[model samples]
Target: MRRPHRVAVLLVDPVVGFDAAIAPTLFGAAEADGEPLYEVVTCSATGGQVASTNGFALVPQAGPEALDDADTVIVPGTRNAAVRRDGRLDDAVGAAVARIPATARTVSICTGAFVLAAAGLLDGRRATTHWRHADALRALHPAVDVDENVLFVDGGDILTSAGLAAGIDLCLHIIRRDHGGQVANAVARFCVVPPWREGSQAQFIEAPLPHDDSASTAATREWACAHLQEPLTIEQLAAHAGMSTRTFIRRFREETGQPPGVWMRSRRLDRARELLEARTLSIDEVARRSGLGSGANLRHHLRRGLGMSPTSYRKAFADREFTDA
Candidate 1:
């Protein structure tokens, strides 16, 4: 059988303590048919007690050598003022980064993009960091395309995320990309997090914290997910959320970063993908169930969104019958 993918977490000095733990926890939780899919290893540039921010020290089992065989290398954010201010990685960290094989995928959480950009890995690539640090990252490396809005940017092999929780989003995204939607959804259920948040979703939403007295669109969104097969209109959703169409539209945009119609369409498309992979439903039936109208309509959306035909997608993704195992 296939060997588990090897992932190395490179703990640079004065790392963001919380950021250091995200990948290990997320990747460690991934499994398929009771077998783990990734072997995650934590390493440091110095191979010993690496001091992290918030008064914590991480004792890695190995050093830079761990990256030699790693199929993926993750650089968690650090609080080193020099790296952020001067746009330079420490000599040891730079050397360790250099050791990562060219074939290996690289990822960064929050300010970890600084290290990657400093090593010239992010040049001409779209990347992101914590929104607070986006300006600094751009100032330091003008060649790097920094977007401060999205949850994460998947640059094929080089990926970067916005901040702490977004790191979880990035890891979950990687799982979803590696193993189809069913496995990722299972892992998300195990972790008690949302199953899907597209990369284009905004990083921050106004009024994220709901007040008890305020009407929330959260319940409506969940309700909509259950009824995607129906023709869900903005007016209907607004009524469900106890607001006028204009008011609901404003609140929905504030809360989800996308207008009501866009968000719902994206959600329906996601459901279409899941059904395409996990079910034996025909194209017409899948289209009807996903509320994309008919086979022709589904074909249009799938081609525009995924650049592939339904038959082709099903052939590629319908490998194993998906069960919530």
Candidate 2:
């Protein structure tokens, strides 16, 4: 049997307790064929007690040594003075971060990007943090491209997420990327969270709630998901919702933080990905079923969105049995 992937979460002093817990909870729930897929360990600079912003302390299971053989290393949000203020890593924290193997993927949640930036791990990379702190991050580390709009930025080897709940999105995304959508969806089901939220969705929505409580585009969204194989237009959707085209478009953007057409395209792409990962359908068949029109269209969108062909995506995530069901 293949060994489970090893994940080391390095908790900095005064860590955001919520951020520190997300990885262990989500990664622990991922499994294949009734076997765990990841072995997560919580560690700190010296294996000693660490302070948290939540009025408590954390006693990690290990020290910096845990990072030596880790497949991935994560840093949760922190209020560490040096890193947060002057963009300099604390000596002990710097040493701990340097111990992470060069090949190991690195991640940060919320202000944890500060630590990564201070360590120079995010240099010349596009990353994000909590929107409130985005300016500070950019001012401190001008070499890092800081985008505060999206929920997270996946820079391949170094990934960074926005505030608290966005951590869940990033972790699920990691699971989906590493295994397949099926495994990620199983984990999401167990955790009682939505299966997927596009990373490009706005981090701070101007109007998350509908102005009229009696009306919502949610049902229309569900209906649209069911009918993705058809060409769905704003007029048809508005007719179904008993609203004018303008109102439907406005409400759709207000509720989903994306315009109607963009949201629909993203949904179609998601469907195509699921088909690719879980079935043996031909490229054209997958395209038709997912409403992407043809093999050429599907290939175009897949390459444009994910930089991979349908066959390559299937080979990366296929043939895995999800036992969580």
| Candidate 2: stretches off by over 4 Å | 205-208, 211-215, 319-325
Candidate 2 lDDT (Cα, 0 to 1): 0.91
Give the clashing pairs for model 2: none
Candidate 1 residue pairs in clash (backbone atoms < 3 Å): none
Q: Write the per-residue lDDT of candidate 1 for residues 1-325, one digit (tens) a residue.
A: 6678899999988899999998898888888778888899999987878898979789987999999999999999998766888999778888898899999999999999999999999999999998888999999999999998998999889999998889988999998877778888888888898988888788783345557535678889999999999998899999898999998998787778899999999988888888988658999999999999999989999899889988888877655333222
Predictions in order: lDDT = 0.88, 0.91
Task: Please write out the lDDT profile of model 2 over residues 146-194, one tens digit for every residue.
Answer: 9998889998999999999999999999999888888899999999987
The superposed Cα distance between candidate 1 and the true structure at residue 140, in angstroms, equals 0.7
